[model samples]
Target: MKNALIIALGIITGAIVIGGQSFYHLLTSQNIVNVASGEVRLGEVYDEQLTTTVTIIGDDNETPILTITDATDQIVKDVKQELAQMVVDANKTLSAHEKMRLETAYFDTNVNIELSTEVEYHSQYQKDMQLTIDETELSHHASEQYHFAEAVDMLNTYASKMDTIYHQNDSFIHKT
Candidate 1:
C-alpha cells in the first residue's frame, strides 16, 4: 500500500539518521576534526592579471612586514573534545532535535580564528610571541553571532529538564 511504503521510508530515514549520529558520536567521542586553510581571494573585477611586491628596509631590530599567506595551527583535540562533551552534557535535557541543532550551530563557530598581524621585535623573541592580529581577523564567529537561537524554543518549557541534564555533581546522571 502507498501508506505502508511511506511509513517504511520514514522509519528507514529515521534509523539512518540515528545510526549516522551514533557513528559520528563514536568517532568524535574522543576527538573532533579541525582543519586549516587559507582565506585569499582576487577581486571579481579585473582587466588583466596583477602581482605586486614591495620591499622593506629595517635595522637588526623591530620592523613591520606585509605578506599574503594562508596557514593554520590547531588547538589540542582533547580540549575540543572535552568542550564538546561539556556542551552536550549541558544541553542533554533538550529534545534530540534541540540538542543536535544547537551543537551543530555551536561547533561551527569555535573552530576557525582568522585575523591580521603586524609584528616587530627589537630583541630576540620566539616566533610565536611576535604574532599579532587586527580587528579584521575575526570576520566570522557564526556560533557566537547566532548565540543558541535554535535552543531558545525549548528553554522555557524544558528549563527544568535541562537543569537536571546538566547537573554534573554526580557522574551517574550523564553516564549514558
Candidate 2:
C-alpha cells in the first residue's frame, strides 16, 4: 500500500508538470500571434500617415525638398526593416523572457519612429511657414523677420532633438 501511494504521487506530479508546460507554450504562441497582428496594424497606420504627409509636402516645387523627402522615406524604410527583423527574431525564440524583451524593443522602436516623423513634420512646417513669410509683403518687415528667425530656431531645435534620438536608438539596438 505504501508503494502504491508513492507511485500515485509520482504520476500526479508528472502530469502536473506536463500540463503546466503545455499551458505556457499555448500562452506564448498566442502572444506571438497578437504581436504579429499589432505589427501589421502599426505598419498600416504608418504607411497612411507617411503618404498623407508626403502628399502635403510634395505640393511644394522645391527640388532640394523633394530630395530630402526621398531621404526621409529611405530612413523610415530602414527603421521599419529593423523592426521587421526584430519581429522575426522574436518569433524564432522560444524563451518567454526573450519574447518579452523583444516586445519592449518593438514598442521602443515604434516610439522612435513616431518621434522622428513628428520632428520631420515640424521641420517641414517651419520651413513652409518661413517661405510664406518671405513671399508675403508684410507691412511689419521687422516682425516678419523676427518670426522667420523664430521658425528657423524651432527647426534647428527639432533637428538637434532628432539627432539625439537617432544616437540613442542606435546605441539601444547595439545593446540588444
Q: Who wins the TM-score comparison?
A: 2
Q: What are the TM-scores, per candidate, against the unseen true structure?
A: 0.22, 0.28
* Cα-based lDDT for every prediction: 0.34, 0.32
Weakest lDDT window of 10 consecutive positions for candidate 1: 45-54
Which segments of candidate 1 are over 4 A away from where they belong? 1-72, 76-83, 101-103, 107-176
10 residues in a row with least lDDT, candidate 2:
129-138
Q: Model 2, residue 26: what's the lDDT? A: 59
Query: For candidate 1, what is the total of clashing residue pairs?
Result: 2
C-alpha RMSD for every candidate: 25.6, 22.4
CA lDDT of 153 in candidate 1?
Answer: 29
- Residue lDDT tens for model 2, 53-157: 121111122331111232323444433344446466655765655553322342211010112232211121122110000011112222232222232233344
lDDT of 1 by residue, 98-162 (tens): 76533454424332222232222122121122212222222224445433333232222233332
In model 2, what lDDT does residue 46 have? 13
Candidate 2 Cα lDDT to native: 0.32
- Estimate the overall C-alpha local distance difference test score of candidate 1: 0.34
